[model samples]
Target: MTETLARLNATYTEHVIEDFQKKRVPVEIPLCLKEDRIAYGHNLEISYPLKEVLDVSYRYEPGKIGFLYIHTIQGVRTFQINSDPAGFVEQFHQLDHL
Candidate 1:
């Protein structure tokens, strides 16, 4: 098993069935960094390996929430975060040497 290096909260879109209707809702989930991958969701349902990650960045306005972007071979995945992800990005870079 890979050791978890860091943990953060991220917003994810989850589909729900309510009153016989399907709806998309934003849910907060745990995002984790491991030795070789970044995992998302409470159960770690989604993951992107370090080798697949092209870049990671955060964008935000002063006194406002920020967005974390993970560029991977598959595509770019974004997460809404309340604070700067500089440490997370730096840690990932240090681990991946990218």
Candidate 2:
């Protein structure tokens, strides 16, 4: 993550992983939960009863880059990383531009 994104999260509210209107590769941007500075790689998860991860680390590899956020819903948050990071970003942008 860039410093800008980190800063943005700090100065805002809960970042939402929003679904695009055209609905291709969904892209989500996390916002701050409060107007406080959220540090890099800070863990912020929510729970109703059973405590679990609401978001995981966003990984970036030579061929792939992705943010994995897990929820109690289990199957709902399960997916595969079948492409490189550049490819993934391009594909997502293409879907958004469509």
Candidate 3:
């Protein structure tokens, strides 16, 4: 098994009852970065291997949430992240160099 380099949670929207009304709420999902792949989802059902990762980037807003983009061979995947993605991006870059 490969060691996990970093773990971050991505936010997704889910329909739920709030104040007796159905509303869209943010849900947290697990995203794990291994030496070879990035696994994400409630049960880590989806993953993109490092070899398939074309690029990674983060977009931050002044007062809004941040976004992380993973460009893979398959397609571009975006994740809504609440915290700074600088650390995660840095780690990915470091591992990519190895």
Candidate 4:
């Protein structure tokens, strides 16, 4: 069973789903990093297997913190949230042990 390691409320700012096209949309969803996958969604759900996550990184700007995730199948996606970015890195590092 994959347990939820950390959960954060994030906004999908990179892209969105529109009428028959994948476009960029701004929406808030629950993001979770579990034992075996990273999942995020509200009414819909998307999950990326940990094995396919090639790399994880973070960036700090003047007023915003971002998390960058590179996955094999999902490509590269960035998420900006209001939580501590350092904590996010630490959480993922812990997940690496699992």
Give the candidates in order of TM-score, highest first.
3, 1, 4, 2
User: What are the root-mean-square deviations of the candidates from the true structure over C-alphas?
Assistant: 2.2, 14.4, 2.6, 4.6
lDDT of 3 by residue, 1-98 (tens): 77888888789899999789999988999888888999998888888989999888999775688899998888999999887777778889887532
User: Which model, 1 or 3, shows the larger lDDT?
Assistant: 3
Model 3, TM vs. native: 0.83
Q: TM-score, each model?
A: 0.80, 0.23, 0.83, 0.66
Model 1 lDDT per residue over 1-98, tens place: 79998877877678999999999998888888888899987799889988898888889675787899999988999899876677788888788435
Tens-digit lDDT string for candidate 2 (10-46): 1113444556433334333332222222222244442
What lDDT score belongs to each candidate, Candidate 1 first? 0.84, 0.30, 0.86, 0.69
> Worst ten-residue run, lDDT, model 2?
3-12
**lDDT accuracy of residue 42 in candidate 2:** 42
Considering lDDT, which of the candidate structures 3 and 4 is the better prediction for this target?
Answer: 3
Better of 1 and 2 by TM-score: 1
Model 2 segments more than 4 A misplaced: 1-28, 31-59, 71-98
Write model 4 residue lDDT over 33-91, tens digit each, in one string.
78877788884278878788766666655467555453445578877776655655568
Give the lowest summed-lDDT range of ten residues in model 3.
89-98
Prediction-by-prediction clash tally: 0, 10, 0, 1
Model 3 lDDT vs. the true structure? 0.86
Error at 36, model 1, angstroms: 0.7
Ranking by lDDT: 3, 1, 4, 2
